[model samples]
Target chain A: MNIIETVSLALRSLRSNNLRTFLSVLGVMVGVGAVISVISVGMSAQAEIARNISDLGTNIVSVLPNFRDSASQSRLLQMMNVGLGREMLEAVPALSSVSAVAQVEATLAVGGDTARATLMGVEPSYSKIIPTDTAFGRWLVIADLSVHSQVIVLSSSIASELFRGIDPVGKQVWVTAGERRRPFVVVGVTEAEEDEPASGAGRQAFIPVTTMVYRLLPARNVSMYLGQTRSASDTDAAVAQLRRFLSLKSVDPDAFEVSSQQALLDAMKKVTIIVTSMLTVIAGISLVVSGLGIMNTLLTAVAERTREIGVRKSLGARNDDIRAQFLVESVVLSSLGGMAGMALGYAGSMAVSKALNWPPAFNWLSVVTAMGFSTLIGLAFGVYPATRASSMDPVTALRCE
Target chain B: MLKLERIVKDYDAGDIHVRALGGIDLHVTRGDYLAIMGPSGSGKSTLMHIMGCLDRPTSGSYLLNGRDVSRMNDAALARIRNREIGFVFQQFNLLPRETLQANVEVPLMYAGLGARQRHRMSADALRRMGILDRAHHRPSEVSGGQRQRAAIARALVNSPSLVLADEPTGNLDSRTGREILDILDSLNSEGVTVIVVTHDSEVGRRARRIINLKDGLIDSVEAAADEHH
Candidate 1:
C-alpha cells in the first residue's frame, strides 16, 4: 500500500477503538511533558544564576572567613568576629581598591510596623565598586562615613513591606541592636533583587561601615572585605595576592578564603549542567516506560485484528504494507502526544518559573530533544509488533476468528 | 487460465508429517465455472488455499496465465494475486468498522490506484451488486444478503480475471442464498471465471463442472448434464 492509504488505514483502525488510542497517547504525553518541564525549568534557573553572577561584576573578589575551619562555630558568630585589616589589603599591588563588608541583625520599627532585617555595613565607596543601583534618593557619600552619620538605606522588599506606599527616604526608623534602639533616617532604597522569595523576606538595610562599627557594636570589627581588580584579567592575581597578604600578617592561610567572581561563575555553571543532566536521565526512563506501553498496545491490536490482517493479505497486500500500517500508526500516536506534551510542558514551566521568581526559559534545544526522544521511542517500540503482523500466515490468521 | 501439476502439501505438527494434497493435477480454462466439493478433512480447503495462491504447495508446478508462479517470492505472489484474482468469503469478511464503499475499495487500494480511480471502480462494483444505496453503511448495519453482496462487490472491484468464492451462500437464508446464486450466474454469463468451494450440492449444482475429492486426491470430475444461466 502507498503511504497515504497506509496512514489513513492506521488512523481508521485507531479511531475505532478511541479509548485504546487515548490511553496509549496519554502514556507518551506524560513522558514527554515531564522531560520538557524539567529541562526548561533547569535552563531558566541556570540563566538567572548566570545573570546574577554577572551582575556582581567580573573584576570583583570576595575575601571571606573560612567557616569550614571549624564546624562547631556558627556562621553568624564567626562572621561577626571577622576583621580584615586595611593595611593587609593595601599591601597587595594587584588589588587597585578595597571596601569593607560587615553585617548585623537588627529590628527596625516605624510607628506600629516593625520588621527584622540584616544591617549590611559597607564602605561609602562600595556602591562605586559593585554597581549598586538605588530605587530612590541617593547613595552614601564620603562625608557620611567620616562624620558617622546615622543614615540607613532600605532594600525595596523591606521598604514596601514596612512602610507600604509611604516614601521611605527622609523618614525616621528606629534601629535596635545590642540592647540599644536609636532613630536613623532612611537615606535611600536599593533596587529589588531577582532571586528574592515571593514572601518578601531576606530584607537588607545598608549603612556605612564606620557608623556601624563606632555607634552600634561594642567592639570595632568588620565581617569581610570586597576588593576590585584594575582589569578582569587581574582578578586571579588579586585573589592570590590577598591570600598571601593575609598569611604574611600572621593569620593562618586556612583561616581565610579568597575567590574571584569568574571562578564562582564557572562552578555554578558546572553544577547546573550536572543537575539538568541528572533530571533528563530520570525523565528519559519514563519515556522508555511509556514506549513499552505503546508496544503492548500495538501487540494487542495485532492480536485483535488478525482477521483484518488476513483479509488484507488476501486482497494482495504485501508483508511490507502490513508492516508500514502498524509502524505509521505508532509514529502518529507519538507525534500527536508529543505535540500536546510540548504545549503542556511550556505552560507548566512558565507557572513554576513564576513561582520561583525566575524568567520562563524558552529553549528550542529542549523542544528538539524532547520531540526526538519521544519519536525515537515510538519507532524502537514499534518494530517487534509490526514484524509480527507482517509475518503471519493468511490461512492461520483468518482461522483466528 | 490456470494449471497445477503433482501438487503435494504437507503439515509438520511437531513430529509427524501429514500430507494434505497428495499428487493432484488440475486444469481450469478461462470463462469457466467450477465447484469443488468434499467432506470434512477431505483436503478441499487445502486445495482452495493453493488455488487462491494463499499458500505454497510443498511440491508443485502451478502456472497462471502461462506464468510459473509456484516459485515466486512473497512480493511477486502478492502482485500476481492483486492483478489476477479476487476472493469472497462465507462470513462476508468486510472490515466491521469501515463503510461498505471502503470495504469494496480494499483490492484497488492494494493495487496502488489513486483515490479517484478506486472510488469510481468501487462505486461501479457496488452498483452492479445492487448495493449502491447502502454504500456508506457499515457491514453490521446491513442484512446478511446485503453484506454478502458487498463482499461480492469487493471481490469484483479490481476487475480480476478470476474469482474464488468459499462457501459463499453458507450463512444466508435460502431466499438470500438464491439471490447470491443468481448474481454468480449472471457474472459467469458475462464470461468471468468463477470457482466455488463448498459442500452444498445446491451450490455445486449451479456450476458448469464439479470435482469431487476423497482423502487428498481427486475422486471424480463430471460436467453438469443440465445448465441454466
Candidate 2:
C-alpha cells in the first residue's frame, strides 16, 4: 500500500486507543516545550547583557599600576607606580589611540569663589577613549597639547558649583598645586557621569596633561595608560599586543593590572553559553525519557492488536507491511506531540519575555530542530515494537484467544 | 489444480515430538469441493493448515497451480495467499474494530489495490453476500449469521482461486449454519475450489468427496455418490 494510506490506517488505530496515545505524547510535549523555552530565555539574557556592556563603551581597556599595597588607599585606577609609562603605551602598534591622565586634588578659585575639586590632566584622546558627553563648549583639541594651553573643562557639578547658571567657557580659573599657582582658561562643560548619576561625587575639572606635568610639581602620572582598540571585538588583541610591548621593554607584566569591559562581557557570555548547554542536555534527557514512553505505548498497542496482526497476515500482509504500519503510527504520534510542544514553548517564551521586558523570544531554528528531533525520536523508538509485531507467526496469532 | 506429495507435519509439544500429519498424499481438481473430517487432536486442522499454505510441512511438497508453494519463502507464500487462496475462520475472524465493509476489504488491501478499487470490490462482495445493508455495521453489531457472511465476503473479496473454510458454520445455529453452507455451495458451483475442515459428519456429507482422518492418517474415503445413491 502507499505510504499515505498506511499513515491513514495508523491514524485510525491510534484514534481507537487515544488515551494511551495522549499519555505517551504528553511526555514528549513537556520535554520539547522545556527545551525550546529554556534556550530562548538564555539567548535573550545574553543579548541584554551585551547591550548593557556596549552602552558603557566597548573599546576601552585600562591598565593600572599593580600597587597591590594600595587596595585600601584610593579607588582611582591611575596611580603612581613604577615601570608603566606613556613610552610603553605609545609603543603598542595595535592600539588605535592611547590616553594617559594625571588625577590630583588641586585648589580652584574664580574671583574669590573657591572650591576643592579634582583636577584631571588629560590628553585629547581621553575624550574619545572614555564616553564623555559634552554639556557646553568643545572638549580639549590637539592644539591644547601642542602649546600646553592651560584650558580647563569643568564637570557639570563643578560648572554649576562655580559658575551657577553662567556659561564657564572662556573664563579664567586659578589652580594651585605643589606650592605653585597657575591661571587657566575654562574651555567646556561636561556631564556628571557616563550612566546613572553617582551620589556625593566630588566636583572636577580637566587640563592638558602636558601643562599638568610642567606646571604642577609632584604630579605622579603618565604612568597609567588607557588604550582604545579599532573596535570592540579587538579589545583582547590590543591588550595582548600591549602586554607584549611591555615585555619587550624588560618590564614585568604583573607590574600593571589590565581590565576591559570586553573581557567581562566575554566571561559573562561564556557563563551564559555553559548554562544554556547544560539546560539543553537536561532537556535532551527528558526527550529520551519521552521516547521510552512512546516505546512502552507502542508495545502495549502491539500486544492488544496481536489478533489483528494475525488477521492481516492471513489476509496476505507481509512482515514488512506490518512493520511499516506500526512505524508509521509511531512517527505520526511523535510529530503531533512535537507540533503541539512547539506552540506551547513559543507561548511560554512569550510569557517569560513579557515579564522580563526583553526582546521577542522567537527562536525559529530551535523550534524547527525540536520538531525534527521529536519525529526522529519516534522513528528510533518504534523499531523494536514493530519488529515484534511483524515477526509473529500467522497461525499462532490466528489461534490466539 | 492442487496436489500434495508425502506431506508430514511434526509438533513439538514440550519435546515429545507429536507427529500431526504422517505421510498423507492428496489431490483435488480445479473447481472441486472436498472435506477432511476428524475429531479434535486427529490432525485434520494440521492437514488443513498445510493445505491453505498457512504453514509449511515438516517434509513434503505442495503445488498450487503448478507452483511449489510449500518450499516458497515467507514473502512468496504471502503473495500466493493474497492472490491464489483465501481463509474463513471458525470464529468468523473479522476485525472487531472495523465495519463489515472494511473487514471485507482486508485481503484486497494486502493485494495492494487502490482505495477506490478496494471500495468497489468490497461493496460488490458484500452485495453478493446479501449483507450490503449491514456493510457499515461492525461485527459485534451484526448477528452471528451476518458476521459469518461478512467473513465470507472478505474471503472472496480478492477473488482467490481456492477458499479454505475452517468450521465456517461451527459458531452458528442450524438455520444460520445452513445459510452459510448454501453460500459456500454457490461459490463452489461458480467454479471456485472449496476445502472444508470439520468434525461434523453432517457438514462433511455436503462435500463432493469426504476423507475421514484418524491418528494423523487417512482412515477412510467416502465416495461422492455412494452415500445417498
Name the candidate that leads on lDDT: 1
Candidate 2, residue A163: Cα displacement in angstroms equals 14
Per-residue C-alpha lDDT of model 2 across residues B1-229, encoded as one tens digit per residue? 9999998999898969899999788998998889889888889989988887779999988989999888888888888888888898889989987899998988888898998999999999999999999999999999999999999999999989999999988999999998998898889989999999998777787789998899888988886662422
Tell me the lDDT of model 1 at A291: 93
- Error (Å) of candidate 1 at residue A32 is 1.5
Runs in model 1 deviating more than 4 A are A67-96, A107-117, A133-138, A141-207, A210-221, A229-255
lDDT of 1: 0.85
User: What tens digits encode model 1's per-residue C-alpha lDDT throughout B1-229?
Assistant: 8899999999999999899989889999999999999997889989888888888899988898998888888888888778888888998899999999999988898898989999999999999999999999999999999999999999988888889999999999999999999898889889889999999999999998898988899999988654584
Task: Output the lDDT of residue A10, model 2.
Answer: 90
Query: For model 1, how big is the CA root-mean-square deviation?
Result: 4.0
> Each candidate's DockQ score against the native complex?
0.69, 0.67
Docking quality (DockQ) of candidate 1: 0.69
Give the alpha carbon lDDT tens digit for every residue of A86-126 in model 1.
66456877777678877888988899988888888887668
